[model samples]
Target: MSAPSESSSAPRAVNPVLAAVAWLWVLVPFGYGLYQLLIKIPALFGG
Candidate 1:
């Protein structure tokens, strides 16, 4: 019935170690994808 509180919806503060881990979590997958696209795709296509 009542609207949700905005404060309760605010983003939580990230711990430094957790933040670094999260950044690597994103970068590792992205780097692997890029490596597959740039290197593996070219090898498959005889480039």
Candidate 2:
């Protein structure tokens, strides 16, 4: 059996713009969910 090659297994580099956009895509929803949880949860519970 042959051993795996490192050169063939390396991942392709991500584009910076796409990476930034993807990070924002994740962060925006996360931040919004946190905002709603902080502001809405207590109201829903009548606290």
> Per-residue CA lDDT of candidate 2, range 1-47, in tens?
67887667669886899999999999999999999789877777788
Instruction: Give the CA lDDT, 0 to 100, for residue 23 in model 2.
Output: 96
Task: Please provide, for model 1 over 1-47, each residue's C-alpha lDDT reduced to its tens digit, 9 standing for 90 to 100.
Answer: 67787677769776899989999999999999998788767667787
What's each prediction's TM-score?
0.49, 0.49
Taken over the whole model, the C-alpha lDDT of each candidate is 0.85, 0.87
C-alpha RMSD of each candidate structure in angstroms: 4.5, 4.9
Best by lDDT: 2
Model 2 ranges with Cα > 4 A deviation: 1-13, 40-47
Lowest lDDT sum, 10 consecutive residues, model 1, at: 1-10
32: Cα error in model 1, Å: 0.3
| Model 1 alpha-carbon miss at residue 6, Å | 12
TM-score of 1: 0.49
Q: Residue 39 in model 2: shift from native, Å?
A: 1.6
